[model samples]
Target: MDRSEYLVHLGNLEFFHVKTGCCDADLPAQYFCITMFQIIVEGGRNMLKTIHSTVLSADVEDTGLNLAFCFTPECGDYEHEECVNQPNQEETSLDENLLMEEHWRKEESMHI
Candidate 1:
């Protein structure tokens, strides 16, 4: 299969500068990067589990490249904040609360 047939768009690349709190001479702080992408495949929603496992097990050899795969469903009505990449959790909570309250107000207004 051609690369374009399965691989969709590779995006939302992020880099994090991780630091070690403990003073260790041997281990140094390193930068970690994560890249997100979209893939097209056969089967419907029911086959997600098999597809996920296959993708994760694609590479059997340990090449020192740590890989994590996750399939996030499309964001629903009230999941925008949780879906987006957020650096701060406290601020996210406050913002989410405010948004929820606003949504509630709109719902109440519609009922009234």
Candidate 2:
């Protein structure tokens, strides 16, 4: 319903990862790759929002497996507009600076 409520619902949800085998020739015979993932759901709702997943270390000889999981929020229509506008703003600022430099160079040439 609200921001805090949504967060609380997500916080209560259980998170776990499922490992899947990855086929790679470079990996040793004893060493195999495992993929870990967890499903994130909206609080109190049965809807599936996003899937968080990552790759685990494939080195069997290594004592510890370092896992790094990256979570990317699904972009909605409204959020997509903001993402597009940011790049346009940067490009506009760069174009203005280039124009100012060009004008300054022309003035210097005239004085010379």
Candidate 3:
């Protein structure tokens, strides 16, 4: 089977960047997931890149990548502040907020 290419020109589309603490339209709410698989062939290796792109809903995903993020103008100061990455709460329950926060914190701290 052959794959078809499509165009989704997001011209003039803007959104808030709470992660960067800016309102710039740098990172839109566009996601492109690729489930990669590596296999060694005859004296060589290959990767199967399965793209599973999804536009984030009013909810979040657990792909371990920030390819999808929310982009809504700050309704209030509190909202914007909360939008910023916060500390992770220690608990046995599955805490997505903490995981995301920890991911960003690690990524940022490493860059620093």
Candidate 4:
């Protein structure tokens, strides 16, 4: 999979689009949803969780799905607020600048 060079945003929050492989076979991919995601930022210093599942395939088999999900301050509860006013939580306060810089750095490291 190729590295994403963009960050998705919902309102004032920032998110990363993670990809998932399609069903190998024998099942409809739509029957499943991405409930939890493990995102590594700054080379594994931070672990982020996924917020929502955006299905790209319609019950199709062997099709790729791109889910645009956000990483919030809180995890395991879907009802939690997307972002808080805390100025010290670097994981939840992923601004566009930082995300872009990270993306560029990854690209440079990969020589893409």
lDDT of each: 0.29, 0.34, 0.30, 0.41
Question: How close is every model to the real structure, measured as TM-score?
Answer: 0.19, 0.25, 0.18, 0.23
Top lDDT model: 4
If both were scored by lDDT, which would come out higher, candidate 2 or candidate 3? 2
Q: In terms of TM-score, which candidate is strongest?
A: 2
| Superposed Cα deviation of residue 8, candidate 2 (Å) | 19
The alpha-carbon RMSD values of the candidates against the true structure, listed in the order shown, are 18.8, 20.2, 18.6, 13.7
Ranking by lDDT: 4, 2, 3, 1
Candidate 1 Cα misplacement greater than 4 A, ranges: 1-26, 46-79, 84-112
Per-residue lDDT tens digits for candidate 4, residues 1-112, read: 2212123343333354433443334546432122334455666576666665333334655566543333332433322344432467543122333355567678889995
lDDT for model 1 comes to 0.29
User: Residue 26 of candidate 3: its Cα lDDT?
Assistant: 46
Give the poorly placed runs of model 2, Cα more than 4 Å off: 1-11, 29-45, 61-112
Candidate 1 colliding pairs? none
Cα lDDT of model 2 by residue, 34-110, tens digit = 22223355576544333442333345444443222222233222224453355534222323434555687789899
TM-score of 4: 0.23
Separately for all candidates shown, the number of backbone clashes (residues 3 or more apart, or on different chains) is: 0, 0, 0, 0
When summed lDDT is taken over every stretch of 10 residues in candidate 2, the lowest stretch is 1-10
lDDT of 3 at 2: 17
